[model samples]
Target: MSKNVPGIMRQKPITPWLYLVPSLIVMFTFIVYPGVNTFYLSLRNADNTAWASTACKAGESCWGIFENYHYAITSEIMQTAFLNNIKWILIMVTGTVALGLLIAVLADRVRYESVAKSLIFLPMAISFVGAGVIWKFMYNYESGTNQIGLLNAIITALGGQPVSWLTEPQINTIALIVVGIWMWTGFCMTILAAGLRGVPEEILEAARVDGANEWMVFWKIMIPQILPTITVVITTMVINVLKIFDIVYVMTGGNYGTEVIANRLYTEMYKSYQPGRASAIAVVLILVIIPAMIMNIRRFNEQEATR
Candidate 1:
């Protein structure tokens, strides 16, 4: 054997795993255990009354294996929540990405880039629940000179009627979405701005030398170069959107036509005490996220390989 082989043999074989032992223990104790329990609970009835009290052959109506799924699919509020999630995904993703990219490009060369970015990214420091409470006060709607919400106050000052920003099915969903955009836009901006910086100055100057206009160069060169980062940001936002609960919970409590999937899961599990249905909803949500997560992982791996 080579001299190096003897030296390697002298080293502790479990050294690498020694470092991993703590992490592995933590994962098993927390993440893996909880995940397994959630799945196990999902298979049982709400309160586990279906299987625990009797045999698995409990009557069709008495013990339904797929009954939770059926209830989740058919429930009116559940349906509304799912549809609202779709809306949330569409509108929030579009607004966050569009605004983030716009601000990133505009601030890329500004003298006050740091200050501008700091102001925008400041919201990222606040918790989602904290931002919700801040905006809830902003959307408050007490009448007369006592108007508490900034928005209602502004409208009143402008001689317009004070509108309820967080009520009314027609507008409440939109109201909640606005808060979400406010909280997340900064995060998207930071990621996208970093991506923009990665695009070499030399390439941009070369593109200009070839007579490409500002818009053309942006569309043809800068955007293409930054596309990977954009994809990662989008996939991340999609995952966030899929699991969005805090804003809806704080602002509306999933009431007045503003329920989303995660909120529904919370309501089912905690409020309604319907474990089976809640687990079903959780499973459905996991299914929806699987594809987006797979894409994100692939992109991440590709980036790692390139680096």
Candidate 2:
């Protein structure tokens, strides 16, 4: 038995890999294969023709290497779409984290904390497409004596002009961002609230004894202790902001300067039948998401290591 111990240890090592085989197969089939195919397709011309092709599709005969990329970057609509994605990252990420933290902090001390959190977190339960549809009706414009849109109705009641919430570029992006914040703030709040709960009550009592004011307790003790949770929330929001599609698509169909990277990719691949350009956009989106995902994974590992 002692002499056979080494062989048993070797068997254990192989068993883990054997157990991983199914998961590895699934990842390769669903993720790795599609990813490689997308990159290869991105390098080809619009008509799916490689250098060996005798001819191209009728309208895309002129397509060549670098042609789709050039058009994707140079097109005015594409430029606007890229810009809109940037704006979303800036506004949505900041707004969601800030508002979520604020709500979490305030509600943590309230008598009806559970009720307050449940109300705030309700939007997170709804799908993004459903939220977009609901908001769309709320922003509907009509040239009439009365308006159903919440904002327009409020403006008219105040004897002010009704603004086109979704039609104008400047306001449309912000309006869409409001929807994102509404949907995600609850998620942030929930995570932060859990972190808040983990905070040692004894430590807070000690801070109070040390002459620390409520504000000081929050800034010095509460925030520092919850820093890890805050990082997790912000990174998660950043990833979501990068991949935002449903709201922009359902609300505007990438029109009126509300276009985003995902929307552009969908349009290029499906509507325009330009697989190469769409793939390029997809690759870019992946590149943007990879860093955020890495940060999240590292944070998670660090939390586990601490535990």
Name the best candidate (by TM-score). 2
- Per-prediction TM-score: 0.90, 0.91
Summarize candidate 2's per-residue lDDT along 18-63 as a digit string, tens digits: 9899999999999999999987877776787663132234665344
Assess each prediction's global lDDT (C-alpha) against the native. 0.87, 0.86
Question: Best candidate, lDDT-wise?
Answer: 1
Give the Cα error of residue 98 in candidate 2, in Å. 1.0
Which regions of candidate 1 fall more than 4 Å away from where they truly are?
2-4, 7-21, 52-63, 143-146
- Model 1 — which ten-residue stretch has the worst lDDT? 51-60
lDDT by residue (tens digit), candidate 1, 187-253 = 9999999999999999999999999999998899989999989999999999999999999999989
